[model samples]
Target: MAIIIAGWIDLDVEDVTDIIASAKAHIDGAYTENGCIHYIWTKDVFVPGRIHVYEEWSETADLQYHFDNHWYKDMGGHLRQFPRKGSQIRKFRVDLIEPVYDPSGTPRADFFTAK
Candidate 1:
């Protein structure tokens, strides 16, 4: 099963641009790793200091490999350079994935669960 990781990082800086710039290399490097389906860091438009992160891996082993990578090791130091209010990252094991939109541009009700 694939693993999906997602969360937001609240930065202390006035803007997330510089932080993104500094982390660009690390983010780009992730794409070359095995089982990296997607890895992204995006700034929240409504909140200036917030950064949203999303990642997908083929399996738990792949995610573990990411944790053991040098870039992941260096990320902590790089992030600490800029003060941050806080951050959260969570992982979910996906048993199934379905498209939300059908070919005809209609919503697929079966793809989502009701609250």
Candidate 2:
């Protein structure tokens, strides 16, 4: 099963843009790292100053390296500015995922025959 990580963050007005920018930059820079299948950052549409992070890693070592090097080691000061109000991080294995069709490709009901 793949690893899934979700985190919620609330930021002060001053740090809102900075927090989002940093997260975007980090993901863009790190997505090709050994175990990173997905690293998406999202802002809460309805809630002001709220951010959500989603990560999928190949293994525990890959995730540990990311936290230790990217967030904890390199971004300590930058991350400290964000408020921890009611924030939480959760981790789990993915049991299943629905497949998505590639619309740009030829339209075939069967994925294998699409090409």
Candidate 3:
């Protein structure tokens, strides 16, 4: 089973591009590390001031290393200087994570709506 680290950030309703860029950079660095399968960031289009981050790792220890790494520790400080309202973090094991198929036996055309 893989591990998933999910999180959300509420920016200060100001300029969010910078904070988001920083987060992407951090995730990019983490993705280059061992055991990292995926790292991505997204915004809630319906919610004006929302940011979501998802990380997938091959093992629990690798995910733990990410939390203990310098990027994780420094992100809070950097976001604080920006217009961040709050943040949340959660980690869980992925018992199953696979592609959803269409009725015709092809992969789902819409990634977001696949599940």
Candidate 4:
């Protein structure tokens, strides 16, 4: 099963733009980890001082390894440099994977390959 993490972080800085610029190293470093499908952090379109979090891992073991990596450990200190507010991040264990478009070339919301 795949693990998906999605949510937002409220930064205490004046603007999220500066923080994202400083996060380049951490973001880039995550891509080097094994079983890392995607890792990203960006500012929300309508929110100031808010950063949206999104990540995908192959499995629990992969994510566990990431936790022990230096990149992961350093990110905490980087973020704590500023006075942060509340954060809401959630993790989901996905049981099925499928394309958003079906064979007929039509987009659908329901799962077509779940059986």
lDDT of each: 0.87, 0.70, 0.76, 0.89
Which stretches of candidate 4 lie above 4 Å from their native place?
A: none
Instruction: Assess every candidate by TM-score.
Output: 0.89, 0.68, 0.75, 0.93
**lDDT tens readout by residue for model 1, 31-75:** 888999998889898887998989999999989999999777777
Error of 3 at 48 (Å): 1.4
lDDT tens digits by residue: candidate 3, 1-115: 7988899888878446656776766767787777899887777777777888888899988877888887676665666776667789788887765567855678765664435
Which of the predicted structures, 2 or 3, would earn the higher TM-score when compared with the native?
A: 3
**Per-residue error (Å), model 4, residue 75:** 0.8
- Between candidates 1 and 3, name the one with more favorable lDDT: 1
lDDT of 4: 0.89
What's each prediction's clash count?
Answer: 0, 0, 1, 0
**1 or 4, which is superior by lDDT?**
4
Ranking by lDDT, best first?
4, 1, 3, 2
